[model samples]
Target: MASVTDLQYVALAVPDLAAEREFFGQTWGLTEVGEEDGMVYFAAEGMPHPYVIRLRRDDERKTDLVGFSAASREDVDALFEQVKAAGAKIIAEPGPVEGLAGDYGFRFFDPDGRAMEVVTGGAQRAHRTLGKGEAIPVGISHVVFHSPNHPALVEFYQRALGFRLSDWIGDFMGFLRCNSAHHRIAVLPGPPALNHIAFDVASVDELMRGLARMHESGIHLSWGPGRHTAGDNTFCYFITPNGNAVEYTSDLEHVDEATWVPTTYQPGPNTIDQWGTGRIITGNVPHAEMTPDKGLWQVPA
Candidate 1:
C-alpha cells in the first residue's frame, strides 16, 4: 500500500510569534531556516526534511497542520485517493506545494477536523550526524492526539494512511507506526486535540543534557526526565511559550515489522512513566490538560 514514510513538519499558529520564534530557534535547538509570507521555519540539525516546524502569527494559539512525507508523487496521489475514499474532507487536491519547501502535496481534514498534509519531492536539506552531548533534537519523533472517539480515529489512520498498530496502553491509548520506529503517531480518548509532539535526541545522556539546558533557560519542565514503558524511550516534556506540549525524547525502541506483536499494557502510574521520577514534581501528569484545538476545520494560509 502507498503510505506516508515519515512525519515532515508541524505548523502552528501562535499569538506571540516573537516568543515562539525565539524559543524554537534559540532554546529548543532548531535552526531558523527561513521566513516567508509571515511564517517562520525551523529545521533540526540532524534531519533532511527541510523544516520540521513552521510557526505563524495568529490571534489565538492553535495547530495549523501536521504534515507527513510520501516517497514519491505516485504515493502522494495514491494516499490522496485513499484518504478521500475513506471519507475525509479534502482541503486541496495534490499539486505543487508553496513557499520555501516546495513540493507536491495535498491537504485534508482528519476525522477530528484537524488539518493534515502529505507531500513528496521537497528540497532535502543537507544534514550531519549530531555528536553525543549535543543535547538537541535530531529530528521529529512522534505526535500524540486526543480524540472523542479514539478507537474510531485510530481505525481511520490505519485504514487511510497505512499505519500499523504498535502497541496499546490498555484501551485508552493506541500507538501506530508507519516504519520500524515503534510509533510515529498515537491516540488517546478525550476532546479532539493534540497531546504532545516529541523530538528525537541522540541518547539518554542527551535527554538529560537537554533537561539542564531547559532548566538554565528557565523553561518549566512539565513532565519526565524518566522512561516510558510503551516505547522504552527517555522523556522530558515542556510547555512551549504558546502552551503547546513538546517532548525531548531518546532511545525509542525500533521493532521488526514482520515479527513484532502488539502489547496492551495495563494503565497505571508506572505504566506511562516507569522511572517514577516525573511524578516527583507535584501536579506533573503524563500529558497536558485536554481541550479542543481552536484551529480545527480552518484552512491553512
Candidate 2:
C-alpha cells in the first residue's frame, strides 16, 4: 500500500482557543468549524483540514506533530500495520477520530516521539469543500521538527508511513513528499525544538499578501519571501497567535514517481533559499560538508 495522499491538518493544542481562532480566522482567513468540548477546529476554507489547529495545549505553544494523510484506503490500513511492526504504540485505533468524518485513520508515535496519523479522507474532504487552496492560502503544507537521531525517525516514517524524500537540505534538513504534494513534512536535525507550521497560498502573490498582513498586524517575520533550495517554495515565516512559527508558502515544486531522485545540496546563507529570503541562524544546524556520515534517508535530518 502506498502512503501519503496529502497533508491533513497538523493539529496543535492551543491554550487560548478563541484568541487563536480569532487571529487565524481574521488574519489567515480560516473559518471556524465549531468545536468539541473546548477544542475548536478551523477549516482553512480553501485548504483541506491541513490548516485546522486544535485547541488542546498542555504547555506553551507545544504541538505534538501528527503527520498527514495517505493516498489510498489500503495504504491507510498498511500504515496501521506498518506502525505496529515498526515499534510504535497505537494511541488510537485505525478508525474515525470521533469528531471528523470520512476519515478512517490511526495515530502512532514515531521513533523520535513525534505523533503522526494516516488517513484516506484527508485531501478529498477538503477538496470537496473548498476544491483546493490554490486560490487562497489553503491549509497546512508541512511541519518541521527538531530532534536527535534524525535518521531513525525519518526512516521510521518513510518505511511505516509511505513518505518519500523530495529533497535534502544539507545533512540536517530534509524535505519529504507524501502524494503529489511537493513536501508535506520536513525534519531539521535537532537537540529537539518544534520549528514551524506552514499554510499554502494560491500564488506567491497571495503568500506575500499574507506576509504583508502579518507584518501590518505586528507579528514578527522570522524569515522568507525566498524560494527554498530543497522544496523550492517561495515562503515567508512569522510568529503565530501563539509562540509557534507559522509560514505562508507558495509555488513549491512537485515530484512524481518517474523523476524522483534523492539529491543532496550544501547549506549556506545563499543555499537555504536560492531567491535569498530565508535568513537567521535558526539554531546550531550541522552543515552538509561537516557531517560526512549523513545523507538523504528517511531518518530525521
Candidate 3:
C-alpha cells in the first residue's frame, strides 16, 4: 500500500487570530503567506508550500487538525480507502482543496476525534534561505497529542496510514513515524489535548538564538532548552499567545527501518529530558488550555 511520506502541516483554532498571527510571524519568525475567510497561514523561509500552520479564529483555543503528505496521489486514495475500511469517521470526501495548488485529499477524524488530512500536490510558496537571527521554522517536524485511548489510536495510525512504531516511553507515550525523523506523531496517555508542536531549525545555535530572541521579546519558555532521550533532539518549548505549546528543535534522530529495533523505556527523571535539568512547568496554557478541535482550516466557514 502507498504510505504517507512526511507531515505537511497542522491546523489550530484559537480565540484570537491576530495573536496567533503575531506570535507565529513576529515572535516565531514565520512568514504570513496567505489568509482567507479569517483563516491565516504561516510558513518558514524556503518552504515549498504556502503554509505549515493554519489558524482559525474561534471562541475556544484548541488543536484543529494535522495534515500528512502522502508519497503520491495514488497513496492518498489508498489511505482514504484504508481509513474507511477501519471504520473511522470521514469528515471530507477525497477531493481538491480550495486555494491550495492542485491539492487533492480528504479529512477524517482519528480514533480520538482529532481531525487529520491526507493530501498531495499543494501550491508552492516563494522561497528564501534562512539568514541571521531569524527564528522562523524550517518546517513542522512533529506534533504530539494527548490521546486517552493510546492502544486504539496507535493501532489506527499503524493499520490505516502505514505509520511505523519508533519507540515507546512505556505505556505512557508512544512514538510513531511516517518518515525518518524519529517520530512525526506522538501519542501520550492523557485527555484529548495537544502536547506540543515541534519545528525544525538549522543548528544548536539557531535553536538557542530562537530561545534568546523569544526571551528578548518577552516571550518565555514553558519548558526546555534541553534534549530529549527519545528522538535525541534538542528542544526549547514556549507557550504561544493562544495558550498552546510550540517547540524549536534540532538534531532529531532518523531511524532506518530495516535495522532499527523499537524499544520500550520506563518513565524516569531523565527519560523525558536527557539533560535532566529543565523544570517541568505544567500549567493552564500548554497543559490545561490545549484541547483538540477541527483546526481552523477544516471548520466550516
Clashes of 2: 16
| TM-score rank order | 1, 3, 2
TM per candidate = 0.98, 0.83, 0.91
lDDT of each: 0.92, 0.65, 0.79
Candidate 2 lowest-lDDT run of ten: 292-301
The worst-scoring run of ten residues by lDDT in candidate 3 lies at 283-292
- Ten-residue stretch with the least lDDT total in model 1: 282-291
Q: Can you write out model 2's per-residue Cα lDDT over 143-237, one digit (the tens) per residue?
A: 77666777676777687777787777678777777776778777777655567777777787777777778778887777766777777778777
Ranking by lDDT: 1, 3, 2
Q: Is candidate 1 or candidate 3 better by lDDT?
A: 1
Against the correct fold, how does model 3 do in TM-score? 0.91
Q: What is candidate 1's lDDT per residue for 92-168, written digit by digit as tens? A: 99999986554799999999999999988889999999997999899999999999999999899987888999999
